[model samples]
Target: MTGTTRYLPPGRLSRAINRVVAALTRRGLSLWGSRILSVAGRTTGIMRSTPVNVLAFDDEQYLVAARGNTQWVRNLRAVGRGKLAVGRREQWFTAVEVLDDTRLPVLRAYLRRWSWEVGAFFDGVTADASDDELRAAADKHPVFRIVPTSTPEDRG
Candidate 1:
């Protein structure tokens, strides 16, 4: 109920659901299998591109940050800026790590709104976590939010 428990990675069932949904949505998709793509630079200030399944999006985008300490996250941190492309839409936003322990409550609130996606990750487990613990793990893996600069390109 606390510590890493709150911040645990997606459970098997949830992962399965995500996999299925991704496959279905991605059928015949051309760009990247994952609608959410994380692009970072290879060299300093250069842009490196990688596609990722967007866990959820809010006023800020939510990424699982599962592959902790991976090169993409490292590169994003180095540049402090990047682009997240979803479908035919693209946006440039400044990346920032949310570390405030107080933000866990808010994070939980946000995740609840994304229950379909977030719940699947937890295999429909009661997505419960204390602000303190969620904050701690978030600090470890850290959900990087691309604070939107302008309205996401009109999808309509």
Candidate 2:
């Protein structure tokens, strides 16, 4: 919780699984509520994508980095915006990183929803974890509030 953030890069097998999931999500198929997150690389300016679980809470959507301080996190920090695609549906949105103190509920909700898939990244914390435990782990995970950007279609 109050210790260093944990970062576990995808292994070769994990990368391959992600690629497959991304392909499906891009083509309009969401595997267990997944989306392909596309953001521009900070250094190269090229589009980078990875599969992510989108969390909806209290009429607000969020993107949580379960793995902690990942490439997408850095990229989002740089650009403050990105696109999420599921199938042919795409949404552009600006991101605001949630503050550390406010991240507990979001983190708890995320674990409750996605722990089956990403629980290992949270050290031993579970969705049933106490508030204090969750607060402690807040520094390791980054949560972003998603604000949809106005697009031409929406404007018209």
Candidate 3:
């Protein structure tokens, strides 16, 4: 995917909501497939956690940056791996950034699945939006394919 350096950051209200959802997912109460993503910070190496909407399309799992190039996206790019936690269960996985040209289908599926929550960030594009529209908006969103890693060292 293209660098989301110019994507908008989450506002205070959105941040607050994410915190709440994250807490719930961490406690194992998944809200509409939500999960708490934990990745090591690029600078501090401290584990940074955020609530994310995990999308399952076809037979693979994905993580989409609905809020654009946020901290987690940057951290994921740096670390190349992370964990998805729901309550007590955690799944370790390495991430591959999707190419810009391949993002439309994934973006469409994501919007279709979570539009009520993330549609606004797409500048009015909905799940029903045409491919051209979705393609036009693809660069603004960053998507990563999640590959399950058996062990922490497996990420390498």
Candidate 4:
């Protein structure tokens, strides 16, 4: 593959997996599942939401930008923050957009840790935008790392 070309597409498979996992988790197979969180666009002020696979790693909640350059990313960027309601739990959090340089290492690490789950991305089976494309996306859509301003009570 050329340096400009992507080894994989955006996280299409990851999203599909998220959907399935959420369904299974909701069915009581797992304790927690992903959810569709809403946030308002900074420019238009329109409310938009998307389902995201979330994890509580290192005390901070994180969400992956599966679609890469999807509108939800833009919404997070515009508002510079957002809220998430997963299962019966609801809370608001501030967003910090993760740049590629910062994101790559983290994503790599996450991929390593969650390899079986995120296999599609690592195996090049997932559709992924190019690095340049993702860069443009970060500039356009942006990955908003949600960090809660207050302590979210454990609803588990």
lDDT by residue (1-156, candidate 2, tens digit) is: 134446789889888999999888888989877999999999998999999999988889999898898889988988888988998888889898997767788888899888988898889999888888887777788889999988855311
lDDT of 1 by residue, 1-156 (tens): 112323344569756865665454445342322553445565855566554544444454555454345566766667666666644566677767655563465457545655554444433333386554555445444456656566444210
Tens digits of per-residue lDDT, candidate 4, 71-127, equal 666567566666666555666788777665555434544445554655554434222
lDDT comparison, 2 vs 3, better candidate? 3
Q: CA shift at 107, candidate 2, in angstroms?
A: 1.0
Candidate 4: lDDT over CA atoms? 0.54
Clash number for each model: 3, 3, 1, 5
Report how far off residue 45 is in candidate 2 (Å).
Answer: 1.2
- Give me candidate 2's TM-score against the actual structure: 0.90
lDDT of each: 0.52, 0.85, 0.88, 0.54
Q: Mark the regions of model 4 whose C-alpha exceeds 4 Å error after superposition.
A: 1-33, 113-142, 151-156
The candidate 1 region of ten consecutive residues with least summed lDDT is: 1-10
Stronger candidate by TM-score (2 vs 4):
2
lDDT of prediction 3: 0.88
Ranking by TM-score: 3, 2, 4, 1
Best by TM-score: 3
